[model samples]
Target: MMIRSALAGLALALTFLMTAAPVSAQTVRVGIVIPQSGQFKLLGDHVRQAFEVWNAGNPGVFSDVVEGDDGCTEQSGKDAAAAMAEAGVDIVVGFLCTETLAAALPLLTAEGIPVMTLTVRADIIAEEAARLGWKFFRLAPRAGSEADIAADAIFRLWADQPFALIEDGAISGRELVEAIRIQLENRGLKPTFVDNYRPGQATQPSLMRRLKSAGVSRVFVGGERADLAVIAYEADYQSVPLKFMGGDALNAPEGENPIPEGTIAVLAAAATSGPEDQAARDAFAGHGLIAEGLRIPAYAAAEIIGAAATRMTYGETSLQDLLGQTTFSTALGPVTFEPDGERREPGFVLAILEDGSFRRLSIEDTAALAGDSN
Candidate 1:
């Protein structure tokens, strides 16, 4: 009778252990809701690579990646959010395009999942936060902020030279160009010319002629990669002496044709082979991924999730408390959020295309530039 009783107790203990094993291994799962296959696929791929690198260094922190095709559309974003919620992911870390993010915001907020967005449009983030609550945060600089950084660099470089402003009619592009113009105007320098162009139309010979006629020594262009590249190529082909300046979209990696030489691209501060950055890069390389824009932000998002999970008393985490208290020291820089979930401090670097590769240019006190609306 005693032996039989002991056997029964051992069986009960084994059953409990078996049940708890899976729960223990389920550390923290984050859903990366970005377009895996679409126009924004490149951006999505970079975000994934960055997350993988973070996961590799800190194993068991991020359990899985749930892909969602948010394709910069409202309907698609809704579908993506539904899929992520169904997967029971703890957090979500991406939305490269603004429209998609706007659509996904309410759905993710309702699910009580923290979303760290990489989209640069300020209005989308502000509107979503105002409509929702503190469920969303942005990692990238705002469109106006980025444009102002580029403008500051240009103004400093060619204070005496006449400049022209060219804008593509996208929401972000238009805002950036206007901001740049405002900054120039504040410095008592008006743009020699301002023109709007539709994205992805054949090279406008008349527009190019006007730019050349303006005789501006330097020009600031706000447009997508293809549009900007076309303008640069046309300017080069025409042998215009004008140097061009634009945003990071121009720095995007390409095959064969690239942004013409004698052009400067202002971009987010990039890592240059430090121990932390190299380790992160190596981890991604192991997975056949290359880190690019918003890549560091993705990795930082994972780290933030892990830290929040660790802080939970009973190992039962809530997105609100986790994000509210977390401060991530990422490869990019120290990341802490404001009440509205925007970065407390934003920074950018001016990079020049040197020998077919983007190289960072040193700028002092980027915070001052951030504050300088002029």
Candidate 2:
């Protein structure tokens, strides 16, 4: 009877171990939602590669990747969200389009899944996330941040100087310039002149003439890179000696007119080549990939998820709670999210375009540069 009882206890212990093996060894499933079949495929491919690079370094975490075709459309977004929920993904990442994110949020929210969007930076979505209680995290800069940063930088550098505010219709230029104008005005600062300019013109000589007439030495133009290029060129052509500043739109591809040297803009630091990005850049180079555009942020998103997942597994905190409260180190430097899921650190910087590239400058540097330009 004693021998039989001991054998029975051993058998029960074996049964328990077998039952828990699969549960303990289960790997995380990460849902990648991006446009796999559309005009944005190239961009999506970049994001996908970043995840692959990240996974190569950390093998056990998120061994399975559920690819979702966002298609950059509303219906596809819904389909992707549903599929991810059905597949039981631990978290979702790589949403580049506003349409895709807007459609997926409600469904993912219902499923209690957290999402870290690499793009889709419209301010409305952030506000909606807070209002609707969606577990959404934004890794990209907010849409109106350009205006806010520009206003603050301009106020610091050119508050006492004669400066004008101008914008075009391209890329929501009106809204950005107006926001900057209002912010500066609220700070008790007013522009010397303000007007709307027609974009895509071959020559902005007339605009330059008007700016010259205003007796303003500095101008902040909320317009496209191409338009700003022309305006700056025309200013140089007319010998106006006017120093030009712009919002983040200046970071876009150069137009027929090369962006003039010494042009200042408020923009984010380059995702690659910084001290913080060295490891990521080396990893990308090893895999024959270049870190550009949406790739670095996507990589950072994966790291955030992996770290949070590990912490959640070892602690009593939920992934959502951990993400909201903890500051994670990434290739973009230290990233912290507000409870609403907006990234708080690594804000926009003041940069000067020189010899065809933008070099970030300090506020003190910007002040000195602005004074010299005038």
Best by TM-score: 2
Worst 10 residues of 1 by lDDT: 365-374
Candidate 2, which ten residues in sequence have the lowest lDDT sum?
A: 19-28
Instruction: In model 1, state the lDDT of residue 358.
Output: 66
Clashing residue pairs found in predicted model 2 = none
For model 2 the TM-score comes to 0.89
lDDT of 2 by residue, 1-374 (tens): 12234588797777777767643223468999888876889878888898899999988888698888878878988999999999998789977888889999999999999888887768899899999999999888777777888898788778878999998965588888889999999999999999889988989978888999999988898888888888888988888877788877787877688877778887765432467778888889999988888778888888887887666643356778888989998887788999788888635667888788887775677667657645
lDDT score, candidate 2, position 36: 83
The models' CA-based lDDT, in order, is 0.70, 0.82
TM-score of each: 0.75, 0.89
User: Per-residue lDDT of 18-112 in model 1, one digit per residue for the tens?
Assistant: 76664432367788877778677877877777777777777865668777776778788788888888999877778777777777878988988
Candidate 2 whole-model C-alpha lDDT, 0 to 1: 0.82
Candidate 1: which stretches are off by over 4 Å? 1-26, 36-49, 63-72, 96-99, 120-122, 169-171, 197-205, 224-240, 253-262, 269-276, 293-295, 315-319, 363-374
TM-score of 1: 0.75
